[model samples]
Target: MPAVLVLLLLSGFLSRAEAATVVARVDLSSQRMTVSVNGVPRYSWLVSTARRGYVTPTGVYRPQRLYRMYYSRKYYNSPMPYSIFYSGGYAIHGSYAVSQLGGPASHGCIRLHPSNAATLYSLVQSYGRGNTAIVITR
Candidate 1:
């Protein structure tokens, strides 16, 4: 019985380790962002994308850098915290005004609620820098 129990525990551990390390999906048309773990949805939030003319690009990208603090020149003094730099100049970052979510408002990046961004930052840290995959689709 003890041997069987040990085997079961090991299997559970291996399963978790085998789980996918990357898990974020963005829907451009709906302007929604969903985060998952091992293929299970963990968090879902409304988001704003680039304006009608400046549409957010749809592609597969990985997080290449993380900035606990960042500033946006376009927004003037407005700063973005817990910024996860994904594509070229685009990123998933915290916003001061979350009320703008679910609208087409961003320049070319994914915006998250301040609280949600903080949580995501922690998750990325655990997943390892430059290891998270983000999939954007229409």
Candidate 2:
């Protein structure tokens, strides 16, 4: 009986561990990204999303792919480090334009400081793609 109880407890613990969720919530108005792990807010960082004529789509999406280093063919071969692609051609990536952070600037993709982008990428990688969500809003 004790062995059966122990087995059940272990199963429950494992299930919980496997259910971890990481969410990156981007607020366009504030130009900030708030990262939450398992529904608990973990970190908040400044970000840049779309400037002037360009638009950053608002929706909830799961990360489709990750790249440690990527260069944009559409935009002057711009370097995008620690990129997390959540929408078609739209990614949350590290930007060299640190001075433009916390304001609209990017063509469309969300932009974070390199270190912050790396941190977020690591969190999503550790949590697994199935458990990661990206939510962009006004």
Candidate 3:
């Protein structure tokens, strides 16, 4: 029985580890982002989501593209460094408005500290866009 239990536990671990290695979970209500690797929490940080009228779409997504340095043409040429574009125009990116994080301040984008965004970008790149999933929830 003890051997069987040990095998079961190992099975669970292997399943989780064999699954997607990188996942970025965003909680809109909490205004936070958590990244996990192989079922282990890797990084957690405050983030800024959409404001009043704007809405940040909540769904499961794989990164569509990555831009280390990008500017928003729709938003007065605003800077969006380390952008991980998940949805059409929405993305997880670094913002210059560090003071505005941890709240609803974005125009529908997920904003993070510049350094944190860079770290996340690197992780996505290393893990492969197809291997990383972004799960946004309210």
Candidate maximizing TM-score: 3
What's every prediction's RMSD, in angstroms? 8.2, 8.3, 6.2
Worst lDDT run of 10 residues, candidate 3, spans: 1-10
Which one is best on lDDT?
3
Off by over 4 Å in 2: 1-20
lDDT of 3 by residue, 50-129 (tens): 99999999877779989999999999999999999999999999999999999999999999999999999999999898
Candidate 3 Cα outliers beyond 4 Å, as residue runs: 1-18
Please give, for residues 95-134, the per-residue lDDT of candidate 2 as tens digits: 9999999999999999999999999999989988877767
The collision pairs in model 1 are: none
What's the lDDT for candidate 3? Answer: 0.86
What TM-score would each prediction reach against the true structure?
0.80, 0.85, 0.87
Q: Which model is ahead, 1 or 3, in terms of lDDT?
A: 3
Candidate 3: how many backbone clashes? 0
Clash pairs, model 2 backbone: none
lDDT of each: 0.75, 0.85, 0.86
The TM-score between candidate 2 and the true structure equals 0.85
After best superposition, candidate 1 residue 32: deviation in angstroms? 0.9
lDDT of 1 by residue, 60-130 (tens): 66778888989977668568899888877788898877889988888888988888888888988997754
